[model samples]
Each structure stands twice: as structure tokens, then as C-alpha cells.
Target: MTTPGLAGFIASGEDSQTCDVVVAEVLEALGQGFELLPERGAPRGGRRRTWFDTFDWRLYRAGLTLEYAAAHRGGELRLTGASPYGDAVQLVTGWKASRPHQLRDLPDGPIATSVSGVVAPRALLPEVTVTGTTAAYRLLNEDGKTVARLLVEYPAVAAGDVRPLPPRLTITEVRGYLTQARRAARIIAGIPGVWPVTQPLLADALHAIGRYPGDYSNKVAANITGRMPAAEAAATILLRLLDIVEANVPGVLRDIDIEFLHDLRVSVRRSRSALKLFGDALTAPLAAPGTALTGRKLARFAAEFKWVGDLTTPTRDLDVHLLDFEDTVRTLRAAKPDDLEPFRAYLKQRRVREFRLLARGLRSPRFVTLTRDWRERLTAIRDSANAGTAATVRSGQSRRAVVETTGTLAADRTRLAFAKVAKRGAAITPASPHDSLHDLRKRCKELRYALEFFAPLYPADSYGAVLADLKRLQDCLGEFQDTEVQIGEIRALATSMLAADEAPAVTLLAMGEVTAWLAARQQGAREDFERRFAEFAGVDGQRRMAELLRGGAA
Candidate 1:
């Protein structure tokens, strides 16, 4: 009958020309059972409102809406529920016009906490603006207690704003007292042209405009089918990855969140991985003119992506260091967190400088040239596949060796990776050198990327199960390496700080404590490796991965 997430109401009407007389008739139906008391300080006139979402709409998918309106004073900065029917909460903060609310503008409250996790690393892309008049009234019961709220809104699309939902009337039911809300619901239900809002206003806003959030991700699978040629498949995958690299640049440059650089680096890494892991398939000779786009030109593009990746490494590593600084200090048991502030400040300063360097490079013509050249190369590769298929018949070359589908090509690559990982996994023992385990981690990462790139071609049930098990093992390995690396970097940073005489004596103590804690954690990850590895390489895990590689049922 009514819901909370979609702005609770007794009933609603859409697309009907609402007026004072219409509202009066609807109120008359309720009679003396309820009284409408209009708030004295209600805002007048229509205000331009804007809702922000990731390109992919992550918040809405998570049942949250993070909104900010430049033209409204009431609830100008808001986090509301994006669901049609749920107990959605709206947390409000006033909008400061002189300086709009950047991610930092949100105070430490429910809105900030909820949004920080979802929208970080990506700036909020505007979804839509509802420019319309709003008239709100409180519904009171016989005891003079406010039971519900009715809002009559006439929304229109302003010039240049995203247009989707139209103006409407909404009755929001206050929490508790469902009986009173239902009684009120019955009265409004009797009116013609009035109906319940089947869709969330925000959801409708996006859907009507054919837009959604979450435009980018770290694990974006290419839209390649198993039936496509190997080169075509590789190009398809790489092209989408290039788009991810481009999409993340703005966020990275803006420094909206650290995750922007993290994501951009990951896309860069995947490109490098794809080139290395699938180089043979991509470079194989075909019937098309000259060789498929490879050799020096391909190597140059790989070098550029690698260069971008190298630039991002230090800042992201320091970000992780800062993120764990508190927990590291906590591990000291008796140490006051204040002692670590100096070290934390040092890290922040270094990170700011490092990020600025990275951002500058990202905005440079070199980076722009690299992206354009890479896109052009990948596009050329796709065109080669198309040309090869057509020329095979005219040139009298067998399609068998040159034009294999993604299924065979991916299977061969997965086999190569599995063999490497299997060899590495089999060689691991309690007495194995730390270097060996580190090497295995790198090997496992390659296998992980291979599986991810070709996942769509495998049976979901089998592939998903295998990926899950592999992920568990990968997580263990990641922790081991990260801890080891973190411990070293912390110590190195500590040494530099002390050498430069940049930090106080207490900061030295704090650094020692953090280094000790990181060392202990690194050891823990090392000690726990055999168990995690065993689980990952268990008979069942291996069986599922084997099943997936065999192209079992989806």
C-alpha cells in the first residue's frame, strides 16, 4: 500500500494535472479524521535539484541515493533511499554555494559514511534534476500528533538537465503506526487518477532517461563470445579495458578518491597482462596483409601502460600504509596513537606530492598520445581479424590454424597458466624460500587474469566456484606479499625520516612499533600460507577448475 524508501505516502498520482481544487477534494475525502497543517516556513517556488551517482549507479543498486541541489536550502545535501518501498533514511546537511560539497564537504555522518564506500575513487556523475514547485503538509490525527506527510510537487526538466520523471503528489507515511497509515491510504485510494508510485522516483528518473551508474570497474569482462576468432576476442577484451583506462583518468586527475588511481593502475596492469599472457594469439600470422599488429609497435604500447602503472605504484602503496597506520599503532598494545601522528603526516605529505606527479603525467600529452595509440592499435587488431577471415578464402589459406575461435585459444592460455601455477603450487613446502612463494603469487595473479578475461566463455557454476577457491588462495598470497612489501617500505621510510632528522623521537618509537607489527603480520601470512594454499589446491578446487576448463554445462 505504501513504502518508506520511495518517500512514504498514503497514495500518489502521476501525470495528472494537479491543482488546489484536486488537492482539496482528496483532503476532503479524509474528512475530520485527519487535519492538514501546512508548515509556516515551507519553501516557496521550484528549486533545481540534482542527484549524483557513479556512471554505473552504484548507490541506487545499493539502495541509497546521494543527492545535492544548488538551488534549494532545505535538504540541499541529502542521502536518501533509492528503493521504492523500504525504511530508507534521509540524512541532510546544508549546501554551501560558495564552495560546493566535494567528497570532503560531507560531514562525518550517515550520509558521508554510506557514500564514502560507494562513490569514492569516482566522482558523482549527475543523474537528473527535478525543477518544480513543492507544497508539503503534515497529516495530524485526533491527538494532534503528526502521523504522515503529503507533498504535492510539480517538477519539470530545466534546460540542459537530465529529463526523466514528471511532477507528482506523494504521501509519506511516518515510521510506526501502520494502521493509521493504512486508514489514510484507503481514503486516498478512492480518488480517481490517483495511484501508488510503482517505481522509486530516483530509479524512474534514471530509467526514464535510459541511464544508470557504475560506468567503470576493475574487473570489466569483454563482451566477446566463445565463437569469435581469437584475435577478435583479444581485441574486444583490450578495447573495453582501454575504455576503463580513459573513464578513470578524470577521476584520477581530480583526486576524488584514491581508488581512482588504484582502478586506473589495475586497468593498466590488465592490459599489460593480456598482452603478455595472450601475446601468441594476438600476434599469430593470418591471411590479412602483413602480420597481425604486433612486435615493436605492440611493445611500445605495453611500455607506455607499464610506465603509467609504475607512476601510480608508490602513492597507492603509501595510501595503503596510511590506511593501516592506525591498526598498526593499535597493535603496540601500550602505545598512544598520538605518537604516530608525525609519521602519518609525513606519509600524507609524500603521498600528496607523489599523486600530484602522477596526476600531472596523466594530464600530459604523452599519456594522451599513449591512450590514443593503444586504442588505434587495438582497433587495427580487430580489423585484422575481420580482414583475415575474409582473405582466408581468396588467398587459399586454411582458417584452421589462423582463425581459431576464442574457446580453443582461451583454453590453451588457461592451460599454460594452470600448468605454471600447478608447478608452483606443487613445489611449495614449509622449507621453501620466501622468494619462491613471492614468485608463486605473481604466477597465480597471471592465472587469475586469464580466468577473468575468459570467464564469460565458461560455465558460470563451474567457473564461479573455481574462481572463488582461487580467490581465497590469491588473498592469502596477496596478504603475504603486501605485508612483506609494507614492512620493508615502512622501515625504509622510517630510516629516511630519521636520517633527514625530519621526525621527533616519539615518531621513531611509533615507527618501530608499526614496523614490528607489519613484520609480525607478514610472518603470520607466511605461516598461514600452507593451509590457504592447501584449500585452494584441494581435490575439489582442482576438480572444479578442470571442469570449467573442459567447457562443462553452465
Candidate 2:
């Protein structure tokens, strides 16, 4: 019943006392049905191993693991499944670098291509590194075909001070040899002082270094409850948002990748959205002297976050521009992409300047004060709710605890947001001004954020259905807005370039052509908006939204 490719830890005492006897017992347990054969040139000792994953553990979440190992001869990269059953595809890359932070740093090959596909735009950071000596043996059946493989590893943490870890035995099942692999695993488990490993060895190694995989994530994961105080719920979400914002700051400063800044800005924006949607929910009176922590008090922090968003916008916009430049070039009507090289150069230069400003702002005392004060305030609100502090609504009505629960508050907010979206969307006519569509887009975004924030308080199916409809509508709005913004930005950039004497005649013409194409795209989005809105506002979608609202109340 043992899982193939299962790993077990061997007690140090038993391993040291009966190392040879343990191997003999495994061989004997095979009962001559299988023969043990030592693999030729197996690494007995002194191989450096490093485990790679994104900061968010993207590969681990995707059920894959990437490992780089170097020996006296060369290095090899292996991409393996993280399942109990071993599955691996490897490339024998020979010592490309000490460490590659990004996919581009990896040599061109299948491994690199596969990794790039998974961890797009995120840096592949070394999660754990260890020096281990492994002895490999193959289990062969009577037909002389390998049925299973076993690796006995003696690993130590590869840090400043060497710390030895427990020895492990890994039973790797060959394809179509599940029975043989299970037998090997059973024999190993039966051995005295050997215990099955619940987690992977990489997790163990990471623990030695006081780290764990998937420590950072950009998603909002507030565990809000139906009966929980709204203030506490809001604080929980804001605190998590702050954590995301702070975690991404180091990556942003290091310029590790563009995603860091993007994630940070998104966290800040989401924090602001939470503040807006949860405004009524955050009415719990604080234990502080006199004044309550109302929207007025939070207004300052909201402004500070707005500054953070504005500070990061320039760099992020340019990043989007450069990232989409190739596709834009391909869509051009007249000028060659090469003609836009000067404009691209200008964008890069502007990005560097904007990034410098951004870094300075982030490192400034204002940011430090904002984060620290924000955390303290939010924590105080959470503690006040925990203490069950009395609060009053702004209209001077005594607050009822039931009405102030996360579920009730979320339901009220969701209804209001949906109503706003419905009103704005219904008002839009085919001949309505572009500004009208833009205004409705903002309303749709607010509704989308409300649903997402309070999703845990509603039924999954209902929430999902409503969200899917909204997302479809949002996609159309997003495409339309993006093209509109790009058109304006291109025009502005063209003017600036001309002013700076940086734009050649060809580049100006190319910019004009790209702007025209973007306008056409925007027109197409505008034309298709009615259908997407109709689907979002359809009877089925409305029913789901109603059900979601009722579910939250329940």
C-alpha cells in the first residue's frame, strides 16, 4: 500500500548502526523476484543541489519542481513532477551560472522553455540549496528490465555553518512497475527507525534556513466570516493587502522584474477599494482616547496610498507600452517597427527616471510612516472589534451587531454596487459619448471589486456565476479603456519626442499610424460593448446576483 516514489526518513542511530544490514534487508525482501544493481558512476558525495521556484511558488503550485545540480564535471537541470510518483524531464546543461534569477538567464533549451511558460514575468528564486551525497540503485525483474530505482541521500544544508539533516531513502517507480516500487517502499518502511516523509525534502531543507515556500502571494486571502464584525473583517483584508504591498517592495527596489511593481500597485489599489466598499463596515469604535477611527481618519491613509499609486503609475505604464510594443508594431498600417526604435528608447529612458523617483519615494520616511501607522491603526480597529466596542452609525443611529456583521455589510454593499452598475449600463446608448462609456466602466470595476472582496461571504456557485458575467463585461470595458488610454499616451509621447528633438519624421508617422489603429480598436470595443453588457445584465446573471446577495445575508 506504500505510495511509489514515496520518501522516508531513516533515524540517524539506525542508519549509522545498520547501514549495510538495511540494504541487505531490502535486497532480501525482494525475494529474488528482483535483483539490485548499482548504477554506474552514481554520485556518492559532494554534489551541490539548488531548488528553484518563483517567490509565489508558482512551480510548486503547478505540481512541478526545478532543480539544478553541479558536480566536479558539470551541471544538470531537472524538471520533475512534485507528486508522490516520480516523473522527470532533464537537460544536461553544464554549469550555466551560479544562479539564474530569470528564465532568460537560463540557456536556451526545453527546460528553459518549459520554465518560461510557467513562471512568466516572475523571477525564479532559489528556494533551497543543499550539498548531498546520493547512491543510486536500480531494481531489476527476472527479465533484466529495471522496475524501480532507489536513492539514499545524505544531505546537509549548504549555508555558512553546515547543519546535517536526516538521511532519506527515495523509492522512484519506473513506468509500469508500480508493484515493484510499492514492494521496495514497504520494505524500507518496515525498517526500524524509518518513517514516511509527509512533505518533500525541499521543504525540510527550506525549514533549516528558516524559510518556507509560497511565503508571498499577491492574492487577497482574507478569511472573512458571516457573523464576524465588519470592522475586524475590513482590518483583516487591509492588513493582508499591506503585507502584499510591503512584500513586493523589496522586489520592486531590486528591479527583480516588472511584476513586482505591478503587484504592489495592485495591492495598494485593492486596499483603497476595500476602504471604499467597507466604509460602513468599519464603524467599530476604537478603544483610543475620545474620537472614533472613522472614514475621516482613514482619509489621510487613503490619500497616502493614492500617492503610492500615482508614484508607480509612470513606470508601470511605460512597462505596459514596451511589453505591448511588438504586438502594436505588427498591427501597424504603414511604418516599419524599426522606425519606432527612437520612441522605444525614449520610453526606456523615461522609465529609468520614473523608477529612480519611485525608489526614492518608497525609501523615504513618508512611506515608512504610512505603512507603520496604517498597520497600527488597522490592528487597533481589529482589536476594538474583538473587544466588542460600542459604535454608532454616522447618521447617529445605534449600531446593531447583527446588521454590522461581515455578511450583512457585504450584502448591502454588493447590492448598492450592482445597482450602480445596472443604472450606468442601462443609461448607455449607442450614440452615447465615449466619456459616458468610460464612466460606466468605472462603475463596473467597483461592482467587480465588491463582489471579489465579499466572495467568501456568499455561495460559491452564485458568486462565481455573477463574477463570470461581470468579468466578461469588464473585459470589453478594459479593452476599450486600454485603447483609449494608449491613444492619448501615444499622442502625448509623440509631442514630447518632437519637443525634445528625438522623434524622426518616420517615427512621428509611425506613431500616428499606431494611434489610428488603436482608435479603430477602441471603436470596435465600443461597438461590441452592448452585447457584453446585455449578457452581464441578463436575467440569469441577475438571478445569480440576487442569490449571492441572499446567500451573504443568510
Candidate 3:
């Protein structure tokens, strides 16, 4: 998708230097009926505008932008917005640092609507900042009434840098004046080095400074091929994941965003899943000596990673409650909503305390030892493997081949996971215990993570169908589990809050209502499970899985 704004413009032959010439020609073309007003010193000058997004650059990826120009500009502001992906529109909003930067800072309006739709509760960390000078002009009709406006933007080398960069022109079409706006566009289109560009000025400035979006994602994906050694692939995957864990630790400690810890936990879980899916293959002899871990050693590392996953669960689970508390309260009695505030306070208190403990665990000497050992282990993997008969069978290749590559083994591992999930799913009957569903959820999750780790090895089209089916099944199971957990947490929270005198009967009633609502949702999920599972295990899904497992044109 082409970016919709200035980048979307067809460059006219004249550059910014000659833009004035185009304006002169345009004024001439308009004859004596139009007036070209003198330049006004725009109130927008001298302010350093900074843009922000989540760590993953989520807003930019979703074709949205959020910026907080500083209070340094000092007043109400007018914005001309454009994107290569959408419409160019105008907005008026305020910028002040009354609190930490958040989407809520904007008054209720289109700009706020655009931002909240994207960033939501996520923190708006500074992505980039640029200082620019603004020059404004008014386009007047023959009656001396302004029908359109123009602003020329000159970005500096950096915030407050004296050297001025090339300028960009912004034309604001006054509402109900399409004809005059089109005429202005025609004149501007005729200039060189000056045309509409959709890329945001902040983005353009960042690009000029060699920065970029999507610099981080909550998930880490690696490219693995069928020709690679299993041990080699394991090293490649683990090392990348290890970096993710380390990178997220700081953010997790800062508690800037819940996803930092969520993603950190996911990486740890994916590590454990790799070990289970690969089993003995992780310890298979590489073509070189000391290049692979023994199964016993691999098992120990998986256990440690599991420990890491365990430490983050409670806090994250509670974070989920607080994050959803507003929505959850909406379904309860109006007065009961404020009654839940104390519960929220309790959750936040627990979260902060638990997060500190988590930070301490991560900072401990033992955790350091485990990570150091794991990093050393990555260096031991061989570039290629000489799979014996034992490794051969585990790899799911033709037994006659007598050898297997890590890439081939990766597909085999994914197949084993799918088979396990399929077997588990097929075994569940309506009479099965709640624990059975929980077990199925865990197994299905492991399978899903394994597929993600091995996805690059398969044809995306074929793999995607199977993945979608698996995800649907996972979601069904997930809704069941999350609601159950939430219900339990809410009850326990109510009891604790009451014991602490946070509230009395009102809190208890609120908890009861919330719990009942969750139970109803959980019951609905339970009823939906059979049909969702059937569709997932149906003929079409089976065919996709078969194609994925048998190795299509990956």
C-alpha cells in the first residue's frame, strides 16, 4: 500500500527553492480576482515535536500516527494530516505535559479517535523528534474571503539545529471550496521538487536520520531450513530467543508495558516447547564433536526456562484483570463499578510488588549462571549433522535415507506436535473433566509455538491454513481457561479485599455479579467447544494438516 500523503504526490519539476515561482505563476493564473496574502509568522515555530509508538512500532504498522509536539510551541494547534495508506485530513488538538504522555491527553475528537484506535492503553514512547519552522499563507477569493490556506514546513537537521532542511508544502482546502482547492492543487502540481508526500514529517525526518519503524516485535521468528542440522537450528532459534528475553528484561523491570513481560514469558515458553518437540534430536550428534547437548543437559536447560516462565505468570495474569477491569465493570451494576476500584488498587499493589520480585529473580546470580550456560551451549552446535538410525527415525524422514538434516527434523517435530494435538483433541468428549480441557489447551499451545518456530520451513500458503485451524482451537480452549481463571481470581480478590477492610457487602455483591458473568461466558465457551473442535478436526482441516505434515512446497 502506497503511503497516502506527501509521498503520494507526483513531484513537480521545480524544487522547494522554486516553489515560490509556482505560487507566483498560480497567482498570475488566478488573475486580479485572487489575492496572495503576505507570509505570517506561524505560531507553530520553535516547538520540538516528538512522535511516539509502542516498542514494536504498532501504530505505524497499523497505518496510524501519534505525535506530541511540546508545550514549547505554547497554544492551540492546527494539523494537516496525510498518509500513503489513507486520507489527508485536518485536525485541531492541544499538547501539554500535564501528565506522562498517553493517548488520553487528546480531547475527544477525530485525532484522539484515530490514535486511541491504534495505541490504546499502550505507552507512547518517543519514537523520534524534530524541530521545524512553519510559514503560513492565505489564499483569498475575489471577495477578500479566505477560501484555502498554505503552510510551508522546513525541518531542521535535528531539534534546534541551525541548518535548515528542504521544505514541504501543505495545502489545506477550506471546507465547501473544492473548486478553489483544485485550482491551488493544479498550481502546486506544476512545480518541481514540490508535491504531496504521505510519509509523515517525523517519519521522513527519522528516515533521513537512518531510524526506522518495526525495530522491535513482541515475538521473535527465525528462518530455519530443511537442510540445516537439528542442533544447529536449535542454537539459531534459542540464541535469537535469548536476546529477546534479555532485551525485554529492562522493559519488564521498568513496567512500561505489560507486553514486555508477556513477550518475555512467551519466549521462555517457546524455548521449552522446542525441547519437547525436538526431544532426542536436540542431543543428536552433529557432524563435529561437542557440537550438541546431551539429552540430559538439554532437559535441565528446558527446566530452567520453564522456571522463568513460571515466575512471570501470576503478575501477568493479574495485569490482565486490571487491564480488563473497566470492561468487566461495565457489565456489572453502575454503583458496583466504583466498588471495584479498591480491588483494582489491590491488583496494582500486587503487580508492583510481584514485578519487583520478578526483577530480583532475573537479577539473581543463579539466573545469570543459567543464561551464561545457555549462551555457551549455543556455541557448541554443529553446522551440519550426521544422523544415526536413532536420529533418523526421530526426524520422520524415510528410514532408508539413514540420515537427516535439522530442517527435515524440524518439519518432523512439527508433525509430531500436530499429531499430539490431534490425538488430544480427538480424545476429548463432552464427559471429559475440566482438567482434560486444560491439558488440551497446554498441548495445543505447545503445538502452536512449535509451528511458529518452524513456519519458515513450510510453504506459507499451506502452513497458514493449518495454523489458522490450530489457532481457532487454541482460542476456543483459551477463552474457557481465561474465564475460569478470572472467575477464581475475582472471588479470591474479593475475599482478600474484604478481610483488609477495602470494602464490605458492596464489594462482595460486585464480586458475585462479576463472577456470575464470567461463569456465564465460561459456560458459553464450553457449549461452543464441541462444535469448534469438530470443525477444527473436520475433513478440510485434516487435509490441510496432512498437506502441512507431509511436506508440501514449503
Candidate 4:
């Protein structure tokens, strides 16, 4: 989606040198009935302006923009709605040592209150920087009343070196003069060698610097097709997952927010699942004396990824507890939320220690090797698949006969995964042990992950129906397991706090009430499991899964 802004015109054929010519033509054209009056004391000299967003473009995606200007009108940090004509909430701090990193860094006022919901925890890193000079003119109608504001920009992007950008003309709407503003825009847009700007100036500047807004995302977006070779498809998914892992490393290291570590762990978990489920695709012959390199690499990388996953767990667990601390306390019938302040302090202290280790592990030589070598290996696998496809084309062999495609592999793996879930689920009785339900939950998760991995191979409607059924079952199982874990963790925390002499008798009593609350939740989830699983393995769900399997096979 394009960023919202005023009706803007960018030079289509003219460079910055000849851009002034277009502006001249615009003025001459408007001379017919409209008059251009320069705003007195409007700066003609350029000032540096920097746009900031989360690495994932959280602000931009939310239809908001935040910028700091060195001297545009006056030095200030401004946050505005998407529309260029929208009123801006500004904090006037003329020439500071540094810009605010997160919304909390801004003073508590309209601007801070506005963005607090959007950009908390996530640091607002600068995405693009540009220097531009603007000449502002008021477009007046027949009675000499200003109907619109026109800005002529001479801009350059600051990347490695100063890169001149195409000059732009923007017509901002004046309040109570919508028709005249539209007429003025039409006149400016019709000028030769200019076209209406499709995106914000930030996009243009980012392009000049070889960066883009909203380029980073945590989700896997690999484009896989049924006809693609299994190894290539697996590699494509792994490579995409790897990108997510890498993209989040900086944020993880900085400890910017809980999500960076959360996303990184999720990618690692998915990569492990893909490797185990698609192991056959990676079974290449021996490379060195008596050693199969592909298998060896797979095993080694999987172990390393597991280690990396383990490293982040401690900190992530503590993060979760702290994040949910307020809500968890609210569930207590007798204890006020503040009664658990000691417990909150203990969680924070543990998190700081755990996070130090996490950061160290991420920066270690072992992790460096894992990311670097894993990328190279995945690339080689993808290239090998491409080469095999080329050979099959040349020799006139059927694509399926020469290499395993996603169609065959997805069907085979998904069938096995589904059968595993069905078999385990069928064995569960109302009187079954919690361990039995936990084991079945594991199988359900595996099946869900397999469906997610190969979703591109099936029709969206069929896939969605099947996944919805599986997700209902999975959610029930997840809730049951999570509550049980939370109960255990709370007990452990109580013990540790007592041993450390940190927990008073009152704090322990509060924790006991919280534990009772969690036990009730776990029992509720356990009771609901039977119904959720019945729906998951019900006739309609089974039919959808069969259709999905057939679609993949076909």
C-alpha cells in the first residue's frame, strides 16, 4: 500500500537541474486565474530531515510517520497521521544531541500519548535521511484568498554520498477550500515532464539509499510451487526462515523488545521442524572420505539451532511472566496486584542475568558458524535442485521421475503427520493421564507445522478449513500444557524466592492464591480438550484433510 500524502508531482523526465523549469511552467500556467504568493521568511536553504520507524516499519504500516528535522521551519520532532495535510503533534526541541529511540523517550504529551500504543518497546531506528530545501507558495483564488499551499522541493538523499533526487511539487489542501485545492492540483499535475507522486518522499529517498520501508517481516513468505523440487522447496523455506533469524539479531542483541527474541526462537523452531520432516530431500552422497557432508551438515546445524533455541528460552520465559504479571495478579481474589512486587522483582533480576547469557551466546563463534554455514548449505541445495531441473528439461525426463517435487513430498509427509495425530488422538480417553494428552499435543503440533510448511501446495479454502480444525485442537492442547507449565514455574519461583530470603510470608500467600487460579484454568482446558479434539478429527475435518492431501498429490 502506498503512503498517504497530499497530491504531489515528481519530475518524470527532468533531473534536479532542470526541475526548476517544471516549477516555472507550473507558476506560468496558474497565472491564468490563480496567484502565487510566497510565504515570508520561508527557508530556501536545505536542512537535513530523518524519518524513523521500527526495523519492520511498524509506524509506516500503521499509517503514521515520525520525523526529526534539523531546521525545517524550526528544529522539531513531529508525528503526524498518514495524510500530509493532517495536523501534526510536535515536540519543539531545537537541536538536541540525539533523537528519541522509542515513544517513551518523548515527553509525556499529545505526541507521546498518540504513539505509545504503536511504537513502545520497539526502538524507532532511522530508515532514511535526506536534505531538502522547500519554497512555499500560497495559491490564491479570484478574490485573493489562499485556497492551497504549494511546496517546491530540491532534495538529495544522504546514503554513502549525496545523491540528488528528482525535485517534487506538492499541493497541500487548505481548510475550507477543497474544490480550489483540487483545481490547483490538476493544474500542477498537468505540467509537462511531471507525474503524480505515487508514494511518500521517504520511499523515494529509501530507494536512492537501496533500502525500503516495511522490508523486514518475521513471518515466512517463501514462494513455493507444487512442481518445484523438494530440496529446492525445503531450501527456499529454510532460507526465508534464516532471513528472519538474521534480521532479528541486532534487536535481540540490543534487547530492544521481547518480540525480537520471540520471533528469532520461532524461526529456529520452524527450521528444525522443516529439516526433520524433509530429511530425505537433503540426503546427498558422500563428499569427503567416508563422510556424507549433507547429512553431517544437517545434523550439526540442527544441533546448533537447538542450542540457540535453548539459549533464548530462559530470558523469554521471564519476559512472558513479567509481561503477564499484571493480568495474572488481577485473577487473584484476595491479593492486590502490588502484593506481588517482590515476585516481579525476582523475575526481572533473573531476566537480566539470563539475557546476558543469551546475548553472549548469540555473539559466540559457534552461532556465527551456524548462520554463515547454514546459509551457504541451503543455497547450494537450492542451486543443485535448479541444476537437476535443467538436466531433466534437456534429457526429456518427466520432472517427477528425476527429482522429488513439493507435490509428492508434501503429500507423503502430510499424510504421515496426519496419521500420527489421528493415531495418538484416538488412544486418548477421558480418563487418560496428563502425559498422554501432552504427547498427543506434540503430535498435533507436528501436524499443524507440516500443514503450514506445505500450505502453498493446496487451495487456500481447503487449506484454511483443514488448518482451522487442527488449530482448534491445538489451541486446547496448548492452553492445557501452558497452564500446567505456568503452575510448575510459579512453584519453582516460590521455592527460589524463599531460599533467597526474598519472599515474605504475605508474598508466598499471594503466590499460593495465584497458583490456585492457574490450577483452575488448567482443569478447564483439560475438560475442553475432548470436545476440541472431536471437532478436529470429526467427519468434516477429515474430509477437508483428505481433499487437501489429494490436491497436494494431484
lDDT of each: 0.73, 0.80, 0.70, 0.81
Worst 10 residues of 4 by lDDT: 284-293
- Candidate 3 per-residue C-alpha lDDT over 25-103 given as tens digits, one digit per residue, 9 for 90 to 100: 5445444445767456563577666666777676778766666555533433232334332432333345542323566
Stretches of candidate 3 off by over 4 Å are: 1-47, 71-100, 132-204, 207-210, 333-335, 379-403, 498-503, 552-554
Q: How should the candidates be ordered by lDDT, best one leading?
A: 4, 2, 1, 3
Off by over 4 Å in 4: 1-6, 13-15, 28-37, 44-52, 62-124, 138-149, 158-162, 172-187, 284-293
lDDT measured at residue 547 in model 3 versus the true structure, 0 to 100: 79
Between candidates 2 and 4, name the one with more favorable TM-score.
4
lDDT of 2 by residue, 326-436 (tens): 888898767888999999999999999999999999999999999998898788778777555344344465445334778788888889988888888988998888888
Query: Model 1, which residues run further than 4 Å from truth?
Result: 1-44, 54-56, 68-93, 96-127, 134-154, 157-199, 207-210, 285-291, 387-402, 552-554
Query: Which pairs of residues clash in candidate 4, taking residues 3 or more apart in a chain or in different chains?
Result: none
RMSD of each: 6.1, 5.1, 7.0, 4.1
How many residue pairs clash in all the candidates, one count each? 13, 0, 24, 0
lDDT of 4 by residue, 289-365 (tens): 22223677678888888899899899988988987888898888887777899999999999989999999999999
- For each candidate, give its TM-score against the true structure: 0.79, 0.86, 0.75, 0.87
Clashing pairs in 2: none
Cα error, residue 545 of model 3, in Å, equals 0.5
Worst 10 residues of 1 by lDDT: 4-13
Q: Give candidate 2 regions above 4 Å deviation.
A: 1-43, 82-100, 135-150, 159-163, 171-185, 210-212, 286-292, 389-403
